[model samples]
Target: MEFKNGKITKGFAFLDTYELTVLMKAKKTSKAMKNTMEETQGYLGMWVTEDGYIRHELLPNNRYDEDRGKRESAYQGRYKVTGNHIEYIDDTGFTADGDFVDEKTLHHGGYIFHKKLE
Candidate 1:
């Protein structure tokens, strides 16, 4: 897959039987990293998961208030590759202590990524 000018082009022959390998290689490239940073910063963050169940923390951020003096809030979630979309769950109340402090279910859609199978 190749992303250029805000478009993602798929069907690279080299990626047919090496999708994950190629994707990881692209991910490690400077251009991909820069794009990843830009896209992720444009949103709260991004996450990637395997087997549609396991979760991986990609980026994390905290929201703070200075005027009303409210406690800091966190934005955290996971992504699962489901069919053609990377289903996401966000605002999961992820804490630095590895615990979810919020009482909410903490499951909401985040970002979507297409899964490339080898």
Candidate 2:
């Protein structure tokens, strides 16, 4: 059983039944604090942050059908882009390289990265 929105929402029972629900709440964000959060499009992607992070793709959408074997990965790791080159250091201690074709596209580890859209 559980409480939702400060009230009991559901429950179930058996031959010998006991149930307890805890209602927890978080302080509501102030209007000013809420406005600050809207300043960043955080969900767009981590590309906004300079510190390197790995974004991996498993199945190809449309542009990656030819590289299905490359999409197979038992391990993955972080990446860094310098100039036109992007380097990937896999978790297994293997270093590989690729190229960034454009600002919104990167070809790395036999996979492609594009600016994701909602």
Candidate 3:
């Protein structure tokens, strides 16, 4: 923020040309971040059960089985999502990655997860 003669001239607004200089500069960075979403219900529950229920669980936090519910071992890993790319880090420090093939399809671990009912 800045103070000028009888005006509340601030960081976002510039009195030099009465322009929003700061917001314009940050727009590019904001646009990049906007392309990524975190833990949306659709993405969080990608896996479906045999009974046609979407397993709304967080990845990297638990090892879950469609038949056996959640177990104490396997596939517990943290994940990072940016744009269409996903990175995974498991409990054993193993790292993997995948990309979104489409809005309803994810290509991960050599498997194609589809949003279709199975």
Candidate 4:
């Protein structure tokens, strides 16, 4: 019985060590993701269609405000950009995504938006 108890204790220790290692790895991965997002800041700015009907403002805080057909802030959302691809989760729970075709162009929801020059 004493031998069995010793094995159980060793097993618990192994599990604890494994959990700690996993947590450390997770923290490292999170930092890497944050850095990647920060590097994407160059893409931040206003993007609008040629006709000036739809506008999307990509803010530095990782949130977006969209205007449509003179409607101010038609939609508001949080966004994540990964390697020229973007995912959005709006305040109303609607989700959408887009791709950056280039430094000045974004293609989303069948609409092509150009970066509005300041």
- What would the per-residue lDDT of candidate 1 be over residues 35-111, giving only the tens digit for each residue? 43224333223222233342333333333111111322234445433222233455554322221112211222332
Q: Candidate 3 at 91: error in angstroms?
A: 0.8
| Model 3 spans > 4 angstroms off | 1-42, 48-73, 116-118
> Model 4 misses residue 105 by how many Å?
0.4
Q: Kindly list the per-residue Cα lDDT of model 2 for residues 37-92, writing each as its tens digit.
A: 11322212322112223344322111111112334444556555455565566666
* RMSD of model 3 against the true structure: 9.4
| TM-score of decoy 4 | 0.66
In angstroms, the error of model 1 at 70 is 18
At residue 7, what lDDT does model 2 achieve?
89
Off by over 4 Å in 4: 1-40
* C-alpha local distance difference test of each model: 0.35, 0.43, 0.55, 0.85
Reference-based TM-score of each model: 0.18, 0.34, 0.45, 0.66
**Ranking of candidates on TM-score, top first:** 4, 3, 2, 1
Candidate 1 or 2, higher TM-score? 2
Clashes of 4: 0
* lDDT at residue 19 of model 2 (Cα atoms): 23
- Candidate 1, residue 43: Cα displacement in angstroms equals 16
Candidate 4 root-mean-square deviation in Å: 8.8
- Mark the regions of model 1 whose C-alpha exceeds 4 Å error after superposition: 1-74, 91-118
Please give the ranking of all candidate structures by lDDT, highest first, separated by commas: 4, 3, 2, 1
